[model samples]
Target: MAFTLPFFSAKTLLTTTTTITQFPENPKTLILEQCKTIKDLNQIHAHVIKTGLLVNPTIAENLLESSAILLPGSMDYALAIFRSIDEPNPAAYNILIRGFTLKQSPREAVLLFKEMRENSVEPDKYTFPCILKACSRLQALKEGEEIHAQIVKFGFGTHGFVENTLIHMYANCGKVEVARRVFDDMSKRGVITWNSMFAGYTKSGNWDEVVKLFHKMQESGVVFDEVTMICVLTACGRLGDLELGEWINEYIDMNGLKGNLNLITSLVDMYAKCGRLDTARRLFDEMPRRDVVAWSAMISGCSQSGQCREALALFHEMQKVKVDPNEITMVSVLSACAVLGALETGKWVHFFIKKKKMKLTVTLGTALMDFYAKCGSIENSLEVFEQMPLKNVLSWTVLIQGLASNGEGRKALEFFSLMRGKNIEPNDVTFIGVLSACSHTGLVDDGRNFFVSMTIEFGIEPRIEHYGCMVDILGRAGMIEEAYQFIKNMPIKPNAIIWRTLLASCRVHKNIEIAEESLQHLVRLEPTHSGDYILLSNTYASLGRWEDALRVRSQMKEKGIKKTPGCSLIELDGVIHEFFAEDNSHPHLKEIYNATENMMKRIKSAGYVPNTAEARLDAEEDDKEASVSHHSEKLAIAFGLIRTSPGITIRISKNLRVCTDCHTATKMISKVFNREIVVRDRNRFHHFKEGSCSCNDFW
Candidate 1:
């Protein structure tokens, strides 16, 4: 089977059976020409064999290369032809090497290179570049380095193609420093070299270095292209540097390189991330073409900027345009639903995910879990947790927090135990949830133990949120003095939230002395926040010190502070109904008022008494009673009672902590109607059932 004839001689190779005028005179040239199909190649192959050209190396190599590259499913035939050559050259070995690499079989190329070296077929410049490409694809750093040494030994290191390939190999292998060293050693740098290095830095998240390298390239007067612009915009997005990003945009305009899809996408992302949504959207709308990435950037930007409703609306619009949402789009959409507490929309999204057969990755699964938890769907949250095949620290923490938020503190603690049994180490957020569970359940001792274990056992230093939770635990349990003392003895400086926690607790427990102390610190820390002043003023009013209450009110008026009006949300028939204090502007305004009056009468007869102390101090008794009766949450609840079907649980979300009168009214309504009511206020969830609350009337 071995042939050792001259490589490409035309003298003794002709033995044609057909007419000689039909094909090229040179057999080598004819083999290199394009064939329409495998059938055409087989005919030409038959011609070559009839011409006695099987002994010529060039004809054989060309046939093998054409079959390996152009003809699909013919690499086996190419390999057979390659094996038949008695002493194959490097060019022959390179044909199969490149074929395997192109077919995504990098290991095969490495193996063939080994065979070629053993056969003493010295590699040329072409041989080095092809094999190095295979090494880059495989990320075989050791093999690539071996090739590098051989390149130097063969004196082919000076070749531009070889040098560029080397740079790419090191960069792709994550040895950016080594790649940089190679770049520094190169005497002739081109666009490819700079792009390779910039891409490496970008992959490693070294955006500063990318900017610095780009500056150096500019100073060196090297020509910049679209790829360079993309890398620069990415750096701007990461750094939130709007100034430089704009400058780059100007440069693009000046250079007349507009309408580049990738460059436009980068600019959109950069402006959006830099907190310039208007500019980003303007640029996005002006783009001649838009893709999924452009739409996702806008949606994600809206979600991050606290425009969750806008984000969801845009997602709907994106679908109408027939652009399918990717996983990231769904994640952002789910987050918007969580913020809006739009359970129905979230369910639709979940169904869409299933309908599209989208795989629930850990991140997407975690986002869904968070959405359900915040939307008051603990069952769904737990279901996602259990169904997820993989769990990270965030997954475990979200589930724990969800349980705590739903007033299932005991269950949250038990889940934390299970998490530990699985050897999943708790992070700071995990312990925050653990301590919060104890706080909600009034397990003071458990809270203390977990707080200590956070630092001693897990080495997670107590963050301000953790300390605030501990203060809330003690303060809510009528230990206001202890909470104040705890703040004074803190290792780090206590924040305004800690003092605010103590002040709010003081208001509930009527600890006027410690309330004053906490308010002093709170006012100094946050002078403009109206909540602390309102809390202290309420403390004064609760003690019947009208003058002191008036004094606090005067100070607030002088400082131009106003209390945040309470707002409540109730979902009815998949639509959220919002109500503010004394709000009577609903479309069914008369019916809502009539329902509130009827519910008030029924609850009053059922042993519910109006707690008028929450009303304004300057108001008369009648006015106080009227204000307490028409509070935002009561209005929302009355609307729910009128709109929802019988025996349905009512869920409401509040902007501020529920007032005492509204809390009592909801508990009575829950008992009289034999319905369970769940209210998620600013602080914690209150589950009212049968004249009882999950918080044990503590929050």
Candidate 2:
């Protein structure tokens, strides 16, 4: 306000005299006029003081500017120079305050502004913006409000720079309503004005507001820049608004506004999040260069869409090109590993993180725990949870769920207690894990108490997932009639999963009457799910209701439903090998089949019998034995036995539930071969060791 930059010119400085000790007509006028570097300024100032030249106010002001802005990390020296001035003007104070803010000392900047006011140097428009920025960075709402009062008192409230900084200060303090008021009051909004409002809404996670603000900005005809585009695209990605994202892409193309690489990366992220991977990939390929951000977007997109292998491939490609990844990229990679049960790959990721000495942040730590837990290693999950320095509610919740899913239900409940002891309040998600733990551990009374507490004591109204877990708790513990009654009395409509949970419990308890009822509801809910039909048919066969089972199969045929083939996977030597029931497609199929035959004989000798009751088709006893022996999980286990060394633990991942015969045979095989086998199926883990399973045959 009181100063102008006054276009310092190269020719003007070059034409002037250069020796440090030389005399001029007016030394005070020549103080910084002859100065080129901060070092040169210091040398000249020393000579002038030694020569007894009076440090006039103009010369003093020049020295303040030189010290503050000439070099970085010079704020301390600038403060000393300011104290030396007999009377620091508004210009001198503004320069020092702005310098401190930029030098990463917003606290110092605010303090200097206070001192300037104490000295009775009234602040100009320039001083408020810089000091307000410092207040914004510190989230100092009281100081910012005081500054706003001063701004209005001085009649500078309508000044564009001052008002914008005021908006910024309030927004960063989580006062978006105040920021919006400031935005609406602006008489003539500039592009920077609109961009700041957009930035604030984005920071506050008001995605819909960001979209609405973008529309308002368009209606106002304020031409937006790259920053505005980025904010809008970020909102679109969060909302999964594919149509809006595509429209923005078209607008950018129509206007030829494709200069910034970050804008392109935002487009990539938006399209990827919207499930438009092909479009994302095409944009990715067209880019002349790929930064870590661009690569992370595509990888994250691929992972979210279940193209895990493709995500891994892109990660490897990034590595080959020597582009370093940030935390976002690694998180997506861990997600892919968890979904595919790629334990070795996940371990490699862990090792890579350790080698790089990356911080075990809560997000990353939780992801690592999830990956290990889904890979059938709950111990590693606990270890990671312990290693995390900062544990959020999400971190604790994931650990609890991991323990429950891995059949460590009692341990999970203990962990929940520990989390509570640390004063962390459990939310709806935490209750889901706790209820599932009760289901898995058969703590029916505890489940009932906790379910009631979650609603009445904690004020967390039960969600659909919570109700489903409650059904699972009762159903899983052989309270089949009570579970059916609970579903009938549900306040919320029972989803297919709720009915399915009850049906599964009915099967476990041989409650065929309820099983038929569940099927009737399921037919209207999810008619094409082949799993429900197979489950009911298996229930009938288990009860020796052959005619009913056959009738169910005939109805399935009439409805054009085909049984989803069982599939399993085993990972060895960093390669995932897949198998279907009776699959002979693997390169080592001959060895795998031979191993299966030999393994079945050994397990049978160890007292394992063929559980042929739940076969899809009733056949001769010998034929039934052949059918169960060639199951997908059996083929996968056989492959592991042939390819892996003796005594090495084998692990398999199955898409569906492991059936009765495979579960029994695997237990015997584990004891007979003196090897531990871990199988991760759709819902939970089954660890077979010493002729017993972690589930105790309940699952």
On lDDT, the leading prediction is 2
- Model 2, span 286-390: residue lDDT tens: 888899999999999999988998998999899999998888999999999888889998899999999889999999999999999999999999999989999
Model 1 Cα displacement at 555 (Å)? 3.2
lDDT (Cα, 0-100) at 216 in candidate 1: 97
Evaluate residue 497 in candidate 1 and report its C-alpha lDDT on the 0 to 100 scale. Answer: 88
For model 2, what is the alpha-carbon lDDT of residue 114? 88
Error of 1 at 299 (Å): 1.3
In order, what lDDT does every prediction score?
Answer: 0.85, 0.86
- Model 1 worst lDDT run, 10 consecutive residues: 1-10
Give per-model TM-scores. Answer: 0.78, 0.88
lDDT tens digits, residue span 41-78, model 1? 67667756777776777788888878888678777778
**lDDT at 462, model 2:** 95
- Model 1: how far residue 625 lies from native, Å: 2.9
In the predicted model 2, the residue pairs found to clash are none
Top candidate by TM-score? 2
